[model samples]
Target: MQRVLIRSIFKLSNQHATKPYLLQQHQQEARINSISCYYCVYSSKRGQQENDGWGKSKRHFISLLTLGIGLGGIGTAYILAKEVSALEKTATNNDTHENWHKERRTDLPTYKQEQITKHDTLEKRVWVTYGVGVYDITEFIPKHPGSDKIMLGAGSAIDPFWHIYQQHNNKEILTLLESYRIGNLDKADEVSTEDMGSPWGNEPKRHPLLKPASERPFNAEPPLSLLAENFLTPNEFFYVRNHLPVPVIDAEGYELDIEIEESDTTRSFTLEEIKKLPKVTVTAAVMCGGNRRSEMTEVKPVKGLSWSGGAVGNAKWSGAKLRDILLAMGVESDEKRHVIFEGCDLDPTSHPYGASIPLSKAMDERGDVILAYEMNGETINRDHGFPLRAIVPGTVGARNVKWLSRIIISDSESSSHWQQNDYKGFSPSTDWDTVDFTKSPAIQAMPVTSAICSPSQGEKVQIVNGCINVKGYAWSGGGRRIVRVDLTSDGGETWHVAELEQEDLPDGRHYGWSLWSAKLPVPSGCKQVEIWSKAVDSAYNTQPESFKYTWNLRGVLSNAYHRVKVEIE
Candidate 1:
C-alpha cells in the first residue's frame, strides 16, 4: 500500500507537471480559522508521503463521504458554488452594477450552507460565517465595534484579509484594501475549494445545552461565568444590548458626512479613507449605565431592556484616534464644550437616537477614546458594529454608539432623551412621580464595580472542606486600573485580599476584563457563606452598598457591591 501510494503520487505529479489542473480560486479571508483550511495539511502532498495509491483511495473515499454528508448531490453543491462565484464577480466588476444587485444578498446564508451544517446547531448557537466575501456596507462602516476596519477588503471576500494580521485594526489600515470600487470586480467561476471540518470541532460539549437564540433562554438570569473575563470575550458569549434595529448599509455608496458648524463646511471620508489613519488600539469595557436594570425590577418596574447585569462587554478595540482625525479635518473646536455622536439605531421620537461625552472625555489622553474598527483581532461583528463605533474606557455603555454616522462638535450636551433624561443616578426614593431629568448629570466614568462571576448567587456546593474558589472581575472609571479587590466572606467582617490576574489568563486574561480570585478557607459548620466584594477606583471611589442612594427614575449607576451565598458541607 505504501509503495502504491508513492507510485500514485509520482503519477499524479507527472500528470500535474505536464498538464495544469483547474486551480483553486482564492476567496477573501474573513476570520483566522479560514487561513488554516487553505494550507491543507491532509492533501495529496501528505498522502504521497504515506500510502501513495491506497492512501489516495482512502482520501477519495473520505472526500466522497464528506460531499455526500454536506450536500445530497453535486448539483446542489454547484448552485451554492455559483452564488459565491457571482458575489466575487460583483465585487471585482469595474462598472456600476448596483442595478445588477437583484436581491438582499445578506438574507442568503452568511457563508455556504454547508459550513453552517458543519456546526451542530442542534446544540449551541455559534457564529456561522456561511458565505463568500464578508458583507461590506460602507455607510455602516464607521459604526462597527472595530469602526472602519470592517471595510478592509471592501470590494472582495474578506476571508483572505483576516489571515494576514493577528492584530490588524490596531494599526493604520487605510491601505487595508487594495481598492474599493466593486463594480470592477474580477469574475470567479467557482466557490472556495477548502474542505469543511467538524462543525463541533472546537467547542466544549459539556455545558448545558444552549437553545436557539430566537427561542427564549432556559432562564433570563445572567450566568455566573460570563462576568469573570474582562476582555476579548468569545464572540458567542459577549453581552448584547441593542437599543434599536441594526441597520444594513451598502458598501459601495456609503458616505460619512460631518457637518462642521463653523466655516459652514462639510467634509466626507469614504469608508476607505477613515481606515487609512495610523491604527491604534485600546482595551476597554462598554457597560450599559443601567447594567443591572433587572435587579431594579424589585423596587419599581423599570422601562428598558430587562437586562440582568449581562449587557456589558470588554474587547481590544483597534482603529484611529477620533481626535487625530478631527484635527486633520481642521475641526476648529472654537472652544467646543462637547462632541455629540449619532448612531443609526433610533426609536419613534421626533429624532430619537443616542447620547454623547464631554469634549474632555471625547478628546483627552486618559480618555483613550477611539473610532474603533476591529474587535478580537477581526473586523467588528455585524451585531456589535460593522463600520464605526466609539470606545470609551470605564464609561457607561449607552455612550458607545454603533452604526455611527454624524460627528457634531458643540458647546452643549446631546438633545437626545438618552443623554438628558436617562443614565443619571439619583436618590432611591426618586421615581417617575417625583424625579427630574435635569436633577442629575449624565453618568460618565463608572464607580468602582465588581461582581461574583462564579457560584451563582444561591448555588449549592458539595459540603467538602476543600477551598471554595471565589472569582469575579473588578473595574474603575476614568482609566483607573483596578488597584485592589477586597473579598469579605463573612459579609464584610473578615476580609481577604483576593488574587487578581493583571495580564492575560489561559482563557480571557487580558484586553478586556480584570479577573480576581478568592480561595476562602471553607469554614467549619457553616451552612452558608455570605460573600461580598468592593473595588477602589483611581480616584478612590467605592461602591455604596444598595442602590437606595444610587437609584434614579432611569435606573442608572446601579454599581452596588455584588454579594453571593453558598452552602458548606
Candidate 2:
C-alpha cells in the first residue's frame, strides 16, 4: 500500500506539472494550504501500512483518517501564524514608506504649484491642502466626522467650503489636521482676486459657534448654550463687538497714556510699568447694549447690528484698579467730570475707538473697574485686546474699551461718535428721522434680562418621557443678582420655577448670570409649545411683558421677556 501510495503521488505530481488545473477565484489562496496539508499527512503515515494489499488498505485508511485531523489542524495554525506575521511586516514597511514621503513632501515646491497636487481617490494616496499645509488624508477620510462632506473637496482646495462650514476653524480641529500634514504651502501665492473684496478677507478666525452680526467691524456672539456653561466664559469663546479691526500690538512697545486735563499732565506707562502698580481682581459680566436687538426688531424695524441674545459673557478680570490709578493721579471727585478710554483699534477714518463713563461711576470705590491685562486668568488675546484693556464691572460692553491706549480725565465726556451719538437709549416714539441724541443719556447698566438657550427659537422638541428641558441665563446689570427665573410652555398661562444651576447668593450681589434649568410636562394634545422665560433681579426688576413698548430706533436696551417656539413632532 505504501509503494502504491508513493507511485500514485509521483504520477499525480507529474500529471499536474504538465497540465495544472486552475483554481476557482475563491479557492486560489487556500489551494496551497490544502496541498501542503495532504503531503504532510501522507508522509507521517508512510511506515504504518503493511502486509497484503487488502489488509494494508484497511490499516492505511484508519491511519490516514486519524493523522489527517491532527496534522491538518497543526498545518492550519502554522499557515495562519505565517500570514499574520507577513501582514504585520507589510504594515510596518508601509508606515515607514509613508513617513519618508511625508518628510520629503515637506521640502517640495511652494503651495502655488503644490495646491494642484490634491489627489484623494486612491486608498492610501489621498492628499489635500488647507491654508499653508498639505495633508495626506487618505486614512482620515473614512473616519472623518463630517463623512462625505469632506469628500466633496477630496482632490481640491477645501478653504472655500471650510469657510461656509465654520466648525473647521476650531483649534482642536486644526491641530488634528496638522498631524496629517505632509508639507507647507507656498508663501508666494497671492490672495485670490475673487476673495479680495470679501468682507471677511483678513478677518481673524473666530469660534464657529458664534453668530456673526457684522464681518467688517467683526461682531459675534457664542451660541447661548455655551454662554451658560461656565460662570466665567473662556476668553476664546467670549463675545466680540469690535467697532474696527483689532489692532496689532507689541507688548514690549505698548503704552497706556493717561491725560489729566485738570492737572495738565500726561503720563505714559509701559505694559511692564503698569504691571508694577497694585493689582486687583474682579468678576463681572460684560453685555452688549444691543443684545437681543433681533427680538426688538420683531416688533418694529430697528437700525443697528442684528444681534441675538448671546452677546454677553462673565469673566474674571485682573489689573490695577482704575480708582487707585485716579487717586495716584490726584483726580478730584467731581460728578460733572468724565473718565474717557480710547482703544488703539482704529476705524477706516483712522479715528481712535473711544467711550467714556461719568466720573462717579469711574471713581466709585466698589465699581471694580480696572485697566485689565488678563481675562479669566490668562493674558487677553488679540481679539479681546491683547497687552492691555479696560474692564468696567457693571457697565455696558462699549464702556469696557479694548486695546486701551489712552485714559483721559476731563470735565467733558468723550466726544467720539460712539459716546456722543451711538450706544444711547431713545424713546419708543422716536424714529431715525425724528431722533434727538441729546435728549437721551448714554446707556449705563443693563436691564434685567433672561433668554431660553435650549429649545432654541423655532426648534422641534421631542417629547422625552412626557417632558421637555428648558435652560437659560439671567442677570441684571449693576451687580443685581437673579433671584427667580419663571418658565412657561403655554404662553405664560401657567409658570414653573426653574432651578438655578448655582443657588443665588444670599448677599444679593451676584454680578454674573444664573443658569436656570427646568423640566416642564407637555400638555396632552399640544402640537406646539410657546416657551417663555422671564427673570426677576434682586431689585425686583423683570423683563417687560411685551417688546412693542420697548422698541427703540437704535435697538438699545431691548430687555423684553424672551420667547421661543417649539413644535411637538
Candidate 3:
C-alpha cells in the first residue's frame, strides 16, 4: 500500500545533477532497428524508489506520482457563467479607433448563473468592483465568498472598484467581499499593494513599522508547478507580502548591483544579460514566512497576519545560479561563513524579508538557485516582483525576495529582522520580555514537519476493523530526509509508523514532500481517538508537542505537534 509523503510543502534549496538512464539496453543496426520501447528508470516521467525504507510510504509516493503526470488543455477557456456569440450588433460605424473598442465590448452583459462546485473549485466568473473600470474577475471568482451566483459577472462589471460602495453597494456586498478576502482587510489593490499610502495603489503605504520596498507592491503568488494549468501562478505570483506598499522597479534602466567582497569587486548585470543565462527548471514551493501563524494565536493573541496555511505555493523556477555568477565575478572565500541576500525593498521594521544559506549551499552542484525572470511561462506579473526575484528552493518564503535589485556576497549574514530576530524557533519558556533574538539564528532550512492539509476536523472517516486511515504530508529541513513518521492515536501514549510515498525528485534531491497514510486501529476501550504524528529527519530532529515551549514573542518557526481528533467506531 502507498502513503502520500509530504515534506514541508514549501520549496527546498539545494543542487543535484544526474545522467538520464536509458530504457532499452540493446543497440540495433541503422536499418535493422526494431526493438520494443522500454520504460526507462531515468525518464523525466520516472519516479525514484526513495521511500522504500518506509514500505507503506513508498507505495503512496509512487502511486500519487501519477497525480502530476503532465500538462493538458492549458491556457484554454474556462468561462463558466454565460456563453456569447457575436456582438448583439456589429462593430461601430467609426472605422478606426472606435472599432477597437467595439471588439473589446462583450456581446452579453449580465450573467446570473451559478456553477456547480464539483471539483472543489467554483470554476465560474465572479465580479466585484472598487468603483468603475471593470476587469474580468473570472480568475478570482473561485477564491471569493459572495456566494456562487456572485461569480456570474466575473467577465464584466457590477461597479464599485473606485467609488466607495454607497447606497449602490451596501453591507451584504461588503460582508461577502470581506469574508473571501484571502485574509487582508481592505480593498486588495489600495490596502495590500497600494503605494504613497493613498486610497489606491500608491507609495508610502508603509506599515506602522515598515519602509516601502518599492512604490508599488506586486501582489501575486506564483504557481506551484510548471504544468500548463499553473499559467497564472507560474514561477512568479506577484508577491503581496508587504507590511507596506509595492515598489516600482523600472525594467528599462534597472541595474543589478552585486558586491562580492571575496574578490573585492562589485559588478552589475543588466536585466537583459541575467535573463540570458543557461535556463533550468525547478519544481519548488515558496511559502509565506508567516504561513499558519494563526495556529499560534490559539495559544495567545499574536500580532501578524493570522494566516492559516494558504500562504505558500510551488512553481517551476528558471533563472541564473547566484553561485555561478558569483564565481564568474570572482567572489572570494576566506574568513567568510555565509552569504547574505538583500532586496530592493526595505521596511522600517528592519525586516523587509530576507534569509541566507551556507556559502556551500549556494556553491553546491545541486543548488539550482537563480534570479528568476519568467513565471509559469510568461512575463513576470506586476504583483509578483516583476523584472527580478530570487528563487531559493526549499527555503522560507521570505528569503525569495521579489523586485530584487541588490546582491551582496560577504562574511556576515543579512541585517534584516526577518533574517535576524524573527522566523526562528526558541526555547519553550521564552517570552517577549526575555527572548534573545541573537540566541536563535534566523531560520534557514526548516525542520522535519508535517500538516493535515485536508480532511478537516469533524470530518467522517471510514471504519475497517474498528480502524480509520489517516493521510497527510511530512518534510524536513536542509538535506535531511524524513527517516520516519510516527502516528499516535490517543495522543502521545502509543503510536504506529505510517506508510511513506515516493522518495526522490527529478532534480535528485530527496527534498520534495511525501504524502502519507496510516490505517489507525481504534483503541479497545476509548470513546474517541485523537490522532497526532511527528516526522524525524535523517538528522533525528523531531517537532515538539506545543508552541508554548517553542513560542517566541515574534511567533517565528512554530513547528509544534499537530493533533486532530475523530470519533472511533
Candidate 4:
C-alpha cells in the first residue's frame, strides 16, 4: 500500500510539472489525503497487532519512513517545476522586443549612400535611411498603411518624408522601424540639415490669440471664452487645423482640376472663373475629430494630438456651391459615387493631402457643401486654405480638405493616407499592436458634444443669490440641432435645463453650434462643486456620461459629459 501511494503521488506531480504553483497546491492536498488514508488503515488493523511492544514500534517506524519518502518526492517535484517555469519565462523574454535594450546589437555593419541606392527596387530589395541608420524595409512595404507612398523613399533617406508626416515620429513607429535596421549610414555620406531645407519656411503668420497646438504644420485654436464670444468667429480667430505646411499658392495662377473617373475626362477652373460662379454663404461649425481628446486621455492613454475643446469654431463661409458647380460641368451625381477633394499641401514626395465625401451629401441641396474662397466676408487667408477650400458642412474637419487643388468624381473614395488610415476610431481595447485601420470606417459626422467655456476647470465662481451661472457650447454633427442642454451641479442627482441660443434655421439644417448658459443653485455649505453638462441633439443622441465607455485608441469622437469643478465663495 505504501509503495502504491508513493507511485500515485509521483504521477500527480509529474502531470502538473509544467504548472509549478498549481502543482504545489495539488501536491499538498494529495499528501494530506494520503496520510489520512494511512491513519484510517492503521487504526483499523491496530487490534490485529502482535502483543509485543517491539513489533508495534517497528510498524510505526515503517509508517514514518514511508511518509518521509513521499514528502521528499513532493519537494523534488516542486523544485523541478520551478526551474522549468523560470526557463520558459526566460525563453519568452528572449523572443519579445520588450527586452531589446538588454540584447540590442552593437556591431551593425555600415553602408554608403551609393550602396543604399542600389537596393531601391523590389528586385534588389528596398532600403532606406533615417539619420545614420540604414533599414531594409522590403518586408514592411506591403504592410505599410500608405502603401506605395513609402516606396518613394526606397533607396534614399526618409527623413524629409517623416518631417512632412510628423505622425510617424511616435515611439511605436520608430521602434518598429528600428527592428528592420540592417546597418548604419557611412559618416561621410550623411545628409546635412542645409540640404533638407525647411518646407515650413514660408508658413503664413498666425494670430497670437490662436493658441498653438503644433508649430510646423501650424495647428492652432482660439480660447474657449473668446470662441464663445462671437456668433460668427472672426476670420483670424478661427481655429486652424493644418496637417501640412501652408502651400505658397499664387492667387492669380491658382487652378483647380476637376476629373470624372467614369468618363476619364478632366476640366480646369481658374480662381477668377470659380469666383464668377454663383456664390453662396454657409454658417457652420468646423470641429476637429480629435477635439476634447485631452479628456479621453484621462481615462486611458490614446494616440494623436492632445486637443482641447478649442479645436472648434463657428464661421460664415462664402463660396461656390459644389452641387451647382458639378451640374454646370455636366457631371451627374450618383449615390454610390464619392466627391474626392485634393489639397495643394504636399509632402516632400509631392503627395497631396486628400479626402472624400459621399456624392449624396455633395449633391444634396441642403448639404451646403461648397468650394469656399472667403471666410467671414473676407478673402480667405493662407492659413485657412486661401484661394479655395472644400467646406464640407456637418462633416468632421478632416473631410474638409484645405487648399483645394483638385476635385474628382469617383466610384471609390480618395486613396490618401488620411482617408485610408488616419481619423478613424477603434475600441479602447484595440491598441496599436492589434489595430487594423481597414476594419474601421473613417469618421465623418461627429457625435453630440458640449464643453464648459466659462468658469474653467478650477476657476472660482461668485454665488449670486445662491446660484452660479455656467456658460458653454453644444453641437452635433449631421446637421443635428441642439434640442436641449442639461446641467447638473450635484453629480447628476438633479438636473437644470440650460437656455440654448441657436440660429433660427430649418430642422436638420442647423450647421452651427448652440451656445448654452445655465444658473444652478449651489449645494449648501459646499466649498467646491463639480458642474456637469450634456447635450441632446435633434436625433435624440446624447453625450456619454463617462469617457471610459466612449474611449478609443485614436481618441476621436470623444463626446463625453463635460465636467468642471469650481470653487464657490
User: Best candidate per lDDT, number?
Assistant: 4
Question: Per-residue lDDT for 253-294 in model 1, tens only?
Answer: 445556555456666666677788888888777776766666
Counting clashing residue pairs in each candidate, in order, gives 58, 2, 80, 0
TM-score, per-candidate, Cα-based: 0.59, 0.64, 0.55, 0.77
Candidate 3: C-alpha lDDT: 0.46
> Model 3, range 369-438, lDDT digits (tens) per residue?
7788876666665445667888777677667777675677768787654565446766656544355657
* Candidate 1 local Cα displacement, residue 41, angstroms: 69
Q: Which lDDT value does model 1 have at 18?
A: 17
Compose the digit string of candidate 2's lDDT tens values, residues 447-490. 99999888787778888888898888888888787889998877
Can you tell me which runs of candidate 4 are displaced by over 4 Å? 1-108, 114-127, 135-144, 163-183
Q: What ranges in model 3 sit over 4 Å off?
A: 1-240, 248-253, 262-264, 301-303, 334-337, 346-355, 375-384, 462-466, 502-508, 523-528, 567-569
* Local distance difference test scores for all models: 0.49, 0.63, 0.46, 0.70
Cα displacement (Å) at residue 279, model 3:
1.5
Number of the candidate with higher TM-score, 2 or 3:
2
Q: What digit string (tens of lDDT, one per residue) describes model 4 on residues 93-115? A: 44443333223234466666666
> Which predicted model would earn the best TM-score?
4
